[model samples]
Target: MDLLGNGPHVRQARRDAYREEDSLRTRRDRFKGFTNITTGSKGEGLTCCFKSDSDVMRVIDNVMCVEDGVNCNNISREITFMILNFRYYYHGHCKLRLGRRDQFIHPFVRRALWNDEYLSKE
Candidate 1:
C-alpha cells in the first residue's frame, strides 16, 4: 500500500546479527518520524536495546517520549502500527505485531526465535 513512504532501517535486529557500529545506541530499537501513532490507541514501543539507523533511532525516541498520561497498559488499546526490528549487517527483518486482547508471548517464543516451540509447532 506504500503506507510508509520508504522502509526504515532497523537497528536492533542488525546489532543482534553484527556489531559493526558501536557509536549508535544499538540497544534502542527506535525509528524516527513516527508522528501518527500518537493519536491512535494501538501504539508501539521498543523493548529491544539495539539501534542501526537514524530513522529507527528517532522512532524509538518518539515512543519513549510518551507521557505518563497515556494509559497504554490497557489492552483495549488497538496497536495498528508494527514496531519492526532490523540490523544493518544481515538485512534481516523481524516485526513484533501487537494487538489488543492479546496475552504475553510464551517464554519459548520470547527466547530463541528458532528454539521457540510455537514456531516449530505451527
Candidate 2:
C-alpha cells in the first residue's frame, strides 16, 4: 500500500510537509542553544506515518570535539574541548578523552570519566 498516495505529486507533498515540521523543530531547538541534527527515516522525509520515530542529535556549540594533532589555535577559550582518541577503539565508537583538567567540565561528563582519563561509553 502507498501510504503517501500513488502519484508523484502526493509524495512530494508529503515530503514537503515533513520538511516543514523538521524546520520548525530545528528553529525551536536553536532557541535553546542546541542544534538538532535529524537522522533516520523521519529525517530523510521518508516517514509515511505519524508513528515513525525521528532520531535527533542535539549539539551544544559551547562544547567542541577534535582529534589528536589537530590545530587548536582557532578555537575559543570559552568553549570546552574534548579530545577524540582514535587509539582506544570501542565496537563502533571512538573514545573521548578529557582535553584539559583545569577547565570546567559538565557534571554528567565528569561522572562518566573512566580512571580520570577517558569518557566511558556507557
| Per-candidate local distance difference test | 0.32, 0.66
Give lDDT tens digits, candidate 1, residues 34-53.
Answer: 32221111112122233222
Native-to-model Cα distance after best TM-score fit, residue 76 in candidate 2, in Å: 1.0
Off by over 4 Å in 1: 1-76, 99-122
- By TM-score, the best candidate is 2
Whole-structure CA lDDT of model 2: 0.66
Report the Cα lDDT for candidate 1: 0.32
TM-score of 2: 0.63
Off by over 4 Å in 2: 1-23, 29-31, 88-91, 106-108, 111-122
Model 2 Cα lDDT, one tens digit per residue, 1-122 = 26545456655676677667657877877756666666676555555646577676777657888988888767666667888877757666787766665566655556656455244432
